[model samples]
Structure formats: C-alpha cells, structure tokens
Target chain A: MMNYGIIPISHLQLAMSIILVLMAGLVSAFLKLGLLKSLIWGTIRAFIQLSLIGYLLAYIFQINHFILILLIMLLMCYIAAREATRRVNVPTQEPLLVSFLSLTASSLLVSVIVVTLIITPRPWYSAQIWIPIFGMILGNSMNGISLALDRMYNEVRSHTAEIEALLCFGASPWEAVKNSVRKALRAGMTPTINSLMVVGLVTLPGMMTGQILAGADPREAVRYQFVVMVMITASAALGCLLLIGISYRKMFTEDLALTEDMRQSHN
Target chain B: MEVFFQFTQITHQFAPNGPFIHASGSLQPGKALAVQGPSGAGKSTLLRILARLIKPTSGTVIYQDQNWQAIPPRYWRRKIHYLPQKPVMFEGTVRDNLKLPFELDLLGKEGSLDLDKAKLLLTEVGLPLASLDHDARTLSGGEAARVALVRSLLIDPEILLLDEPTAFLDTETGKKVLMYLANWLQNKKNRGLLLVSHKENNLAFFPGMQAVVIQSEGTRG
Candidate 1:
C-alpha cells in the first residue's frame, strides 16, 4: 500500500519484475535461444525509461501549472507530427506542416471539447486529467494520419493509369483522386473501428484498467474510458481527413500534373 | 500538313545517368505513326512523355507551334489521350464507363451518354449491345479493351496515343478495331493516331503510316 490509498509495488517488490525476467531468461538459456541478451537489455531499457517518465510526471503533477501543461501538450503534438510525417512518401515544401496542422487542430479541438463540455477538469488545463487523455488521442491520431498518408501515396502509384485516364478525359486532379482518397480514409479508420468493436469484450482497455488499478471508482472509470474512446475515434477520423485534404495537393502541380516525385517514389 | 505535335531531344531513364531512351518525331494531322520496339524499349514511356503524364529527364514537346510546358497540362491532355498498355475498367456498367467523360466538368456540358451512339460503337466493334449493362469487371480482356478505346473516343481527342490496344484481341477483332479507328480519323480531318505495337501487320491498316523503331541505347558515353 502507498500514500494515495492505492496498492503500490514497492522498489523492493521490483525484485518481482526481475523474477519474471529471470524466468524468461532461464527458458531462453535452456532452449539455446539467441534472444536472452535482447530480453535482458529490453527489461533494463524499459525500467530506466518508465522510471524517468514516472518521476517527471510526478514532478509535473505536483506543480500543475497551466502554462507548463499547455507547453507539454504542444511538445507532444510536435513529436507526434514529426513521427507521422516521416512515413509519408510524397515530397512537399514542408511535410511536417501538414502533420502538425492536422494533429494540433484535431487534438486541440477534442481536448477543448472533452475538458470544457465533458469532463470539466476543474482547472480545465489540469495536467493530471488532460495530459494522459490528450496523449492517448494524439498518439492514435498520429497513427491514423501516418496510415492514411501511406495508403494514399501507394494508391496514387498503383492507380496511375486510371488516374491519368481520368485526367486525360478532363477530370480535375481532385476528381481523379477522389476514389483513391476514399480508399485511404477507409484504411485509416479500419483499425479504430475494429478496436472499438472488440474493446470491452476482448480486452479491458488501457485507461479503464489503469483507473481501476489506481483505486478510482469503477463506474467513474468506465465513464472516463468511454469519453476517451469517443475522443480518440473522433480525433483519428478528423486527423486523417485533415491531413489528406491538406497534403493531397502536394501530389500534383499547379498545372494539374502529377509530380515526378510522386510517380517515381514507390516505383 | 502542319505538324500537330513535335518532340525534341526527349530523353528518359529509370535511374540517374542510366541507360536512357531518345525519341524525336513529328505527327501531322490526318497521318498515322507507329512506334516499334521490343519490350522495355520505352515505347510506352515515349507516348507518356508526349502526353505529359511523365516528365522526361531532358526534352520538350511542342504542340501547335507552342511549348507544351507553357500550355496547361489539363488542356493539353484534352487534345492528346494516352491509352496505357493494359486497359483499365472502372467498377460500373459498360454504359457507365462510356459516360465517364461526361461526368467531368469540362465534358459534362457535352450531353449525357448517347445510347444509340454507344450501341452503334458496340456493333461496330462486334460487341453485343446487351454488354452495355454488364458489370465492367465481368468483361473479358478483349471486350474491356474495346470499351476502354470507345470511352476515350467519346471525348473526341485530336491525337490518340494507343499502346497495343489490340494486344489481347483475336485477329478478326483486331482488324475490326483498326478499321473503326480508321473510320474515326476519316470522320475528322485534323486527327492523328500514334500507335505502339510489336506486330507489323497492324501497320497495313494505316497506309503511308510512318514507322519509328525504338532501339535502346545502352549508355550515353
């Protein structure tokens, strides 16, 4: 038991973590598996990273400054945008701008709605309440944009002949690519939709389980989880739509020609 | 006859400093030009470059005595239609496929699909009019080829760049397609066709047609 009226695994109990790793280590050694070293190193890495994050989060939570929270949110979005755009194959003046704009727009919109209208986290910029929720939705939205952009670029390559046929027949670039864009949107949404369907029945979601383990009321935890799921789903869809809308123009030129970079990238 | 289109010092390659293809030619109205080459000789690339679907590493395509690059690609593509080697069909009825051009803002005012005209084209191409209602995906290779050709013709392009339009058809069907294409040109005075094919027999369909054989130059130096 710890100070917050919740069960805590003591630093001494971290020996339990070592015990679990040792079990895996013993199995690997007996099987002559090559992964024993990787498993050991992975455990050490996880321990260090999680410990650092835990301390940092505790310090942030104690201070609870609105400006600090806002700045941290901006930092999260910047990292998310950078991670997402790295997967996009098209060359643009600023690929980061597309990801950043979409991610920030969708994340901010959802967070404002959730904090003000739904949860009403007292200080509203409450880092303890908003940060974790913001991180989850922003992370998912980043993934959605990445997947959508990847599929969109691929469809542009695979459907070159069809797209050219449409263009030759006087269809605008937008008109020609509408179908491919639809396919990309669907591809981006599939994971979220599938997860939504299996969420409670197949697996207890991360937020709900975390809350329950932290000694929060079960009913309140379920409500928070529900709001979070909806926020994430909405953010992901908007992120995909916004990213594709903004970046699709980069696929072609002012003269309505598909850029040479787009044609040559994947081929 | 005036030169309807011209390509000057056009060069393209898959990689930088790689084995590139060089093509230079002129197409006049009411004339036919056939591109001959073995597979991978860049016959398709030549047509695509002329169409501006792909940019050449170095070259200029002039249309109507004007630099092609200066002209908007959309307008240029309207005059020059490039058909790929493999015919593509959208998910719809054959009639829907033919009506595709009309769906575009530029061509929408051209009126809806003319069923009588479609039937006439189908009959000319030896396809049953009933095939108009069949799902495009259900079409055989030869039927799909004819549909793709007819769909392009619906736009009434000035220059037709066809890559082996009859590659998948039987001899009888191929001859009919050639004759239809000939009639298409005969009806319009300032029209030309640039065809890429391996078979020389198809050339006889266009008398006095100029032949340009594409030979791959292994290296620049």
Candidate 2:
C-alpha cells in the first residue's frame, strides 16, 4: 500500500509551519495583544493535542470504521466546546455544550452532504479527506464560539445600567440579552468576514497552501480552496447562528439574566 | 446634616503590596464622602464593596440593617449603582449609549426601545436632547462622565456609590453634576448617594451631608 503520511518535503514544511506559528505567538505576546501566559499555554496545549491527533488519525485511517470516525469527530467537537469556553467570563458548560452540539450536528450534516452528494469520495469514512475538512470547519467554529462568548460576557458587565433599564421597563432577560448576543455574534464573526473580504487578495488560505504543496494544478488548488472557503463560511455561519439564535434561551433565565454563575468559573 | 452611609469594620487588601490596601469608615446615606487621601487609600475598593461590585475580606455592611451579601448582588446593584473613579463609555451614539444595553437584541421586538426615556435621561444629566444622537467616542471627558453617570442612574437603583466620578470633569461641570445629585437625593423619592470626590466643593450643598476622610496609610496600591 502507498504511504498515507506526508512526503519528506511535507515534513520539512510542517516543521517550518510549527516554528512560524510559535514565532508569531511570541511576537503577539511581546506586543501585549493579550496575556503572554495564555499564548504559552495555548501553544503547548495545541502542540500536544495536535500531535496526539496526528497519531490518532493515522490509526483511524487504517481501520476505515465509520463508527470510529463519528466517535472521533464527536470527541474533537467536545474539546472544541471546552476551548470555546476557556477564555470566557460566562458559565461555559451550558453554552459550551450547546455550541458543541450545534457545531458537531451542523458540520456533520454539511460534511456528509458535501462528501457524499458533491465530492463523492470513495469509502466515505476516508480519514484523509473528512478528517482534515472537519478539522478546519470545527476549529473555525471553536474560535467563533470563543469570541462570541467573551464578547457577550464583557458586554453584559460593562453595560449593567443599560441592561437594568431594560429589565426595569419590563424587558425579559432574553430581550435584555438581545443586544449583547448580537454584538457577540458580530464580534465573533468579524474575522471570518474580513478573511472573506480579503481572501485571494490578501493571502492564500491554508487549503490552497496545502493543495499547492501537494503538487496539484494551480487551477485545481484554487477550486478546492474555493469550495473549502464556502464550506468554512457555511460552517462558521451555521455554528454562530444556531448557538446565538436557538440555544441562548437555555443559558439564561426567563428574566434575561444569566441562570448560573456566569463568571469564568476559575479558568 | 451628616453623612448617613456607614461602612463599619471594612477591611480590604486588593493584593499584598498593592496600593489602597487599608480602609475603614462610615458615611451616612445620602451624604458625600470626600476621600482626601494621597494617591490611594482603598477609597475605590471601599466604594466597590459597598456597591457589591467587590466583596470585602471581612466586615459587615449594614444597608438598612441587611447584610450586603445576604441580598442578591443584582438587587443591591440595582439599588446601588457603582460609578468607578474613571468613566468608561461604550462605542456608540449618545442615543446608542443611552439605549446601549438593549439596542442589539431588541431589533425586532415591539415597543422595547424607548427614545423618549433616553431623551429625558439626557436632559436629567444636563445634556441637550440633540446629544442623544452624538457619537459616544467623540464626547469630551466631562460629557462622557456625565453620560456614564446618567447611564448608571438608568437602572433607578436606590443607592448611588460613586468612585471618583468627577475626577475628569471641569470645575463647572463637576459642580453642576454634584448640585444635580444633591438636589435629586434630597427628594424623599430618590435613593441615598455616596459620592466620592477630591475637589474643593462646599459640603453644605446637601442637607444631610458629611465628608468621611479616607486615611491613607502605607497600605495602598
């Protein structure tokens, strides 16, 4: 059987990619974009997690088990929910669980539809294709959820007076939370929008980079990246929309107030 | 008249060596506390604890004979709005700032957004009705501070705990805000106000007003 792992050249590229990511992180730390410890911990966690994921994928590819693939994707999504709540100042379990449920459900359906009806890959559980694509989409959703939650919590605390005004005037907690939720959704989706706005013009995206590196035709790579971009957009939109639109009511009480301790819950 | 607000046995240390470490005092409600300490003396923290924004290390704060913690913080916060020493205004129109807590979510709702309420608050805070549409970021320090205060008052809490709310305002603006607050609190319908200020203003403005000096020791951030 042919090798499923990357070529030697790809190994070199991966090493360089890791180094560059670390460097970029260090620079941001120096610039105080946020806490330095956060970057350090994030890098360490990402490295260990991704490495384990790499080994797991290799094993998953050999088995070709649909149940295993489904199970792994669910696990990845569970971790993603934890990530979404990591930096938030709100109670994470409910929202994080909600976000994870939506991300997994939507991404699974979309990926299944795309791969089966559209892409038509042989052996539907082909780890090579479904895994990478799901990784990108679910990862995007994680970041989107993270930003949305942080923004939502902050907006609530900062605008207490305005919130109270609404509550006093007979606005339900949902009614009170409406503005903050919208702002959070907007804030979370901003990076996606900007990337979409400047894609191809600003930078070649990750998918395109991978395709080009794989020695695919430039046109083929562009097409793949285009499809992937649309998928990502759909994924991110669906994740945010479902979580923001549908699940928030369960997070808070009928009075529009947070149902539980909305604090960061000690990291 | 004397300060009615009281903070008995209030002991707070934000951090081991941080400034504003030690503070203990009492101010009769509806009275002003002129925190005249060099740099920091736990004045803000004291105010924060009273407002239920921060909890004290160990102490009892009797707000009408009710343990501050026993009451829901939101209820206390609703009645006792905390205005920090520095005013932080959000990014939006003056009207947006006034309606900020609801604008985003109430988009499709019926009759929740009230323009009239916003204008009346602006006027109450001494801003013209036209200022409602003014950009929040473009407002001067004095204007922002006033808007911030009005925003806090929007909740209609029964107690006002200001932390150096007038530190950024011009003397004229500061005087006006102080006067308005004094007059508002004097009305039996209004809640008691515990204003934190350092400027030289006549203490006799409020009938039941007295100043509690925050003694600054080495314990301050």
Maximum-TM-score candidate: 1
Q: Which 10-residue span in candidate 2 chain A carries the lowest summed lDDT?
A: A258-267
lDDT of 1 by residue, A1-267 (tens): 232546888979977778899999999999999899999999999999999989999999999999898899999999999998886656653678888999999998988899889988777778888788899999899888888888898898888778878988878899889999999999887888888888889988988988888888878878988888889899999999998899888888766768777666323
Residues A16-106, candidate 2, lDDT per residue (tens digit)?
Answer: 7777767878888878787667877887799789889778878988887888888888988998988887666454436667778778876
* Tens digit of per-residue lDDT, candidate 2, span B7-120: 776666555564334455565544555545555566665676676545566677766666665666545555666676656666678766666544433222332336776667
lDDT of residue B62 for candidate 1: 79
Give the CA lDDT, 0 to 100, for residue A141 in model 2.
77
User: TM-score of chain B, candidate 2?
Assistant: 0.81
List RMSD in Å for every model shown.
Answer: 3.2, 9.2
Candidate 1 chain B: minimum summed lDDT over ten consecutive residues — where? B212-221
Alpha-carbon interface RMSD of model 1?
1.3
Error of 1 at A166 (Å): 2.2
Candidate 2 Cα outliers beyond 4 Å, as residue runs: A1-62, A70-129, A136-227, A238-267, B1-6, B16-36, B91-96, B99-136, B150-155, B165-173, B213-217
State the lDDT at A229 in candidate 2.
Answer: 76
